[model samples]
Target: MPEMTRIVLAARPEGAPGPESFRIEQAPMPEPGPGMVLLRTIWLSLDPYMRGRMDAAKSYAAPVEVGATMEGGGVAEVLASQAPGFAPGDVVVGPTGWASHAVVPAEALRRIDPAAAPLSTALGVLGMPGLTAWVGLDHIAGAKAGETIVVSAATGAVGSLASQLARRRGLRVIGVAGGAEKCAYAVETLGCDACLDHRAPGGAAALSEAIGAAAPDGVDIYFENVGGRTLEAVLPRMNLHGRIALCGMIAWFSGKGAAEPMTLPAVWRMILTRRLRVQGFLVFDHFDRLPAFLAEVAPLVRSGEIVWRESVAEGLEAAPGAFLRLLDGGNFGKQLVRVGHDPAGT
Candidate 1:
């Protein structure tokens, strides 16, 4: 019998998760029961959403129980299959968690074509994050050509795609990021019209000034990602009827369950005066659009028009630290852990 390595939730974090929140454990390799498949994790994705799972909070998804594996999505290779359609050595992507292997229902996994794109991408640009960008900006926000659009976390998995997608639509896109490297990538590679460093001194005032200078015509659409100071900076500059797609509130997440103070009165006044159309979206709600999204984005990615960067942490042992870095804005792009070898050589 093979032994498997896994990370389990040792404690629920009240504030930002620390090393004590998780524990490493050894388990016997999982076996596939009827209608199920056994998988070996190849690439484990470390995303900000996983932070919510580390706490016992009300969310769209259930929190990881104490003493259980930390929940996450990963690209895996089928080691054995008791399910009808799946077979040994097939590549699939699903929620297999922070483990070297998993035994899951066949219905829960989606087969990935190695020929379409790199297998790691099933967790990044060509997968959930990319779909999030497309659905939020195109379907929810309904961004149009010649519009001035702003997206925070511009170099992140979802923000990168949203910023570029907005550009593809002939929108003048301004990206809000934390540092010079990311800001430069947004402008030079992602084709954003301008990129603002939110981590710069003077904070909100600096961001507001940059937005005013870049989008002097006023923001027609705002892809809301980091919500604290970035939201405050964007509020006053919104054009009449400007649309906001509320994707993630990373700043608030840093405070854990604690509510961060906001200029609600000012925000409401601007919303009323600007007639802002704001909608919060979850990517799973639009999973049905996967085929459509893949058809449109896959080609661009293959042609190098939709380029992306990755910051990989080697081994399952590194997942927790890598994830912490992701939440702290330390990662430059998509954060993934190479937990095991990719059989496809991608």
Candidate 2:
């Protein structure tokens, strides 16, 4: 039997997650059964969404049980297979969790070429994060050419990709992110028409000013990611017939189980007066759009028009501490854990 490494959540965290919240364990290698594949993980994607999975409480998806392997998305190399079509050494992406190896059915994973993009990207820009941006901004928010768009976490994985995609669509793009460095990256590197620093004093006002200066008309699409005071500010500035695509609420993840009063009155007034269409969505809701999405986004990425960033945690053990830091915005790009090397690079 093949022995492997894995991380399991030891406890539910009260505040920010600590290293102690998880434990690394050795497990027997799983054997592929009939119509199944044995995968050896290469990369683990640590995202803000994983925090929601740790809780027993209900959300868009089911939570990970206490002793189970931490639920996660990962890229893996098919080491063995009993199913048809898959060969040993084919790369695939799936919800393989924090384990070093996983036994899954052949139908559950899709083979991806490493040369199409970095194999790591299957967990990042060209993967769920990019899909999140593409589907949320274009499909859900209906971002159109010549319209104005704004996204919080502007330089991050989904936000950066969304901003650049918005610009390419001819929409005036306004990016909002923490720190001046990230804001500058969003504006200068990512080609956003304007970027506002959310950490600055009177951040909301500055954002309003920046959006006013950039679009002057108003935001037509608001890709809601951070969603606290950020939502409060963006709600009032939406143009008539604008759309708000609610993606994630990172601000709420840190203060887990703490319910804050929502800006419902403003949300309603804006929707009514300005005719805003604010819709909350889970990314999987549009999985059917994946093929179409890949067709549209892949070319842009290949041409170097779109940039993807990764904040990689070194090993399986680092996932817990890294996850905590991710909630604090301590991570710069797509927060991920590298369980193994990119064999493609070697």
Q: State residue 309's C-alpha deviation in candidate 1, in Å.
A: 1.0
Worst 10 residues of 1 by lDDT: 254-263
Off by over 4 Å in 1: 256-260
Taken over the whole model, the C-alpha lDDT of each candidate is 0.92, 0.83
User: Whose TM-score is greatest here?
Assistant: 1
Query: What are the per-residue Cα lDDT tens digits for candidate 1 across 272-329?
Result: 9999989999999999999999999999999998988899999999998999889889
Residue 4, model 2, lDDT: 89
lDDT of 2 by residue, 124-171 (tens): 788888889998887799888988888899888889888888888888
Write down the lDDT that model 1 would get.
Answer: 0.92
Which pairs of residues have clashing backbones in candidate 2?
none
Candidate 1: the clashing residue pairs are none
